[model samples]
Target: MASDVHRRIFDVVARIPAGRVATYGQVARLAGLGGQARLVGYALHMADRPLPWHRVINARGEISSRGDSFSETLQYRLLAAEGLVFDEQGRIPLDRFRWDGEEAPAGPAGEGS
Candidate 1:
């Protein structure tokens, strides 16, 4: 079974809307796991659920490259499908897509209800 911290991270990740993204630090704070950004990354790495792992980036507004270009490319594609646009330098514009900690609407569409 997953620990409470892992569960909390998953919960926070699940709340991130499709078209929006949150940094690992942002997710840690929202999960009440403050300052545990790396922990959040570890949890998502092991999570078997459909959590929006692609929606969680690093504080630099860029995907944390796992030394694998394929996964990096996949993340970019997933976010692009959600309407997120990254800069030519592979940096996402956090100002445009960052989640504001507002509650995600209770639906599959990810719109505020």
Candidate 2:
């Protein structure tokens, strides 16, 4: 059986979509995990297998705080390639680009939704 923390992390990751982003706190809330945003981060940190770790960011749309300098730079490059526009300050404009997590129901025509 999956541990509660692992399940919670997976639940949060599953909700993040391509071209969108979510903060650790937002994912925790959506997973009904209360104020355990740090727990979410910890769980992710312990994960060994590959997952969409890049789709998540801070509430301010910045990368997670646990990587080397090169990793941080790579995060920015990958996000930029995904069409995520950033401001002059190198910060993603959360107000304009925040992922609202309101994807349309999956269907033939809503594959990207």
Candidate 3:
């Protein structure tokens, strides 16, 4: 069974929209598990659901190396399909594509008015 922390991580990742990306640290912080970047990555690595996992990158706006050997290229292709443009050095332009962690306006209990 997925731990609570992992579930939190997945929830945060699931909210990342197309054409935007969140860094590992960003997802960890957003999930209320501050500084647990590695935990976010591990949760994503094990996720079986179809998440926008490709939208999670490193703080440097780049994909982190993976031992699986296929993820890097696949991630790049996935992001590319979303119209995200990478620099010549293969890094997403964080200022352009990075997900700004903004919450929409809400009413009581954090629900939309």
Candidate 4:
């Protein structure tokens, strides 16, 4: 069973719209788990449900290396499909594509308002 923490993390991740991305730290903060960026990554790694996982990246606007070349390649392709352009250094331009959560459709989990 998914813990409340993981559930909350997933809920926040679900709100990340396509064509925009969130950093692990951003998702962590939005989920009411501020400063728990690594936890956000762990929750995502353990997620069984279908999530826009590729929409989450590192603080450097680059995909975190998973050591699985296929997954890394897949992540790049997935983001590209959503119209995200990576620079020659493989960094997504967070300034242009990062989701600020201002247009959030719903509140993050565990928040009343």
On TM-score, the stronger of 1 and 4 is 1
Q: Which runs of model 3 end up more than 4 angstroms from their true locations?
A: 103-113
User: Clashing residue pairs, candidate 1?
Assistant: none
Candidate 4, which ten residues in sequence have the lowest lDDT sum?
Answer: 104-113
lDDT of 2 by residue, 29-91 (tens): 777886988887777767755666676788777786665888678877777877888777666
Best by TM-score: 1
With candidate 4 superimposed using the best TM-score fit, by how many Å does residue 71's alpha carbon deviate from the native? Answer: 0.7
Instruction: Report the C-alpha lDDT of model 1 over 45-90, residue by residue, as the tens digit.
Output: 8997878899999998999989999999999899999999989888
After TM-score superposition, what is the CA distance of residue 78 in candidate 2 from its true location, in Å? 1.9
Error of 4 at 36 (Å): 0.7
Judged by lDDT relative to the true structure, which candidate is superior, 1 or 2?
Answer: 1
lDDT score of residue 5 within candidate 3:
87
* TM-score-superior candidate, 3 or 4: 4
Give all TM-scores, in the order shown: 0.90, 0.79, 0.86, 0.89
Order candidates by TM-score, high to low. Answer: 1, 4, 3, 2
**Clash statistics: count for each candidate:** 0, 0, 0, 0
Looking at model 2, how many pairs of residues clash? Answer: 0
Residue 64 of model 3 has an lDDT of 93
